[model samples]
Target: PSSGNKAERFGTASVAVLVRHKPGRAYISPDHPIAQEGAGVVLTCSAKPPGWPVPQYRWFREIETGDIKSSVL
Candidate 1:
């Protein structure tokens, strides 16, 4: 009976558990009226949690034919 209790405790002790977490992506986009054609415009984009390093940016234009043009900064 003592041996059975020891075995149960050993079995429980041998189990291992772990937890992990990863940072999520942070991104921002230009506000509405992003730009106006044939007029002076400023395209602005930024990342949240200020001071993120080397963030990538992309701008898209919607056309009548459902096509998109991508611009990078």
Candidate 2:
């Protein structure tokens, strides 16, 4: 009740984003290797979504000839 102007006829609506469980393939914790190279490993990235928006883990490192590095966690 406060459109004191003279023109107000804009409309737009859309909603249909249903994504249930999507993160279920990211593991690199103490799953195996006991580590013994530099003696400084604490890698832990897990994922197994079964509900809402709760999945955010960015950690990559594939150097040698692949090129894909971004780690600051």
Best by lDDT: 2
lDDT of 2 by residue, 1-73 (tens): 9878788799999999977667766777778857798797787777664345667777677889887766644
**Best-performing candidate as measured by TM-score:** 1
Lowest lDDT block of 10, candidate 1: 4-13
Candidate 1 structure quality by residue, lDDT tens digits, 1-73: 3665443333334655544433245544444655566886665665453343445566777778987756533
Displacement of residue 11 (Cα, Å) in model 1 is: 49
TM-score of 2: 0.29
**Residue 34 alpha-carbon offset, candidate 2, angstroms:** 1.7
Tell me the alpha-carbon RMSD of every candidate.
Answer: 9.8, 12.0
> Which residue pairs show collisions in model 1?
none
In every candidate, how many clashes are there? 0, 0
Q: How do the predictions measure up, each by TM-score?
A: 0.40, 0.29
Pairs in clash, predicted candidate 2: none
Give me the runs in candidate 2 sitting further than 4 Å from their true place: 1-10, 15-30, 50-73
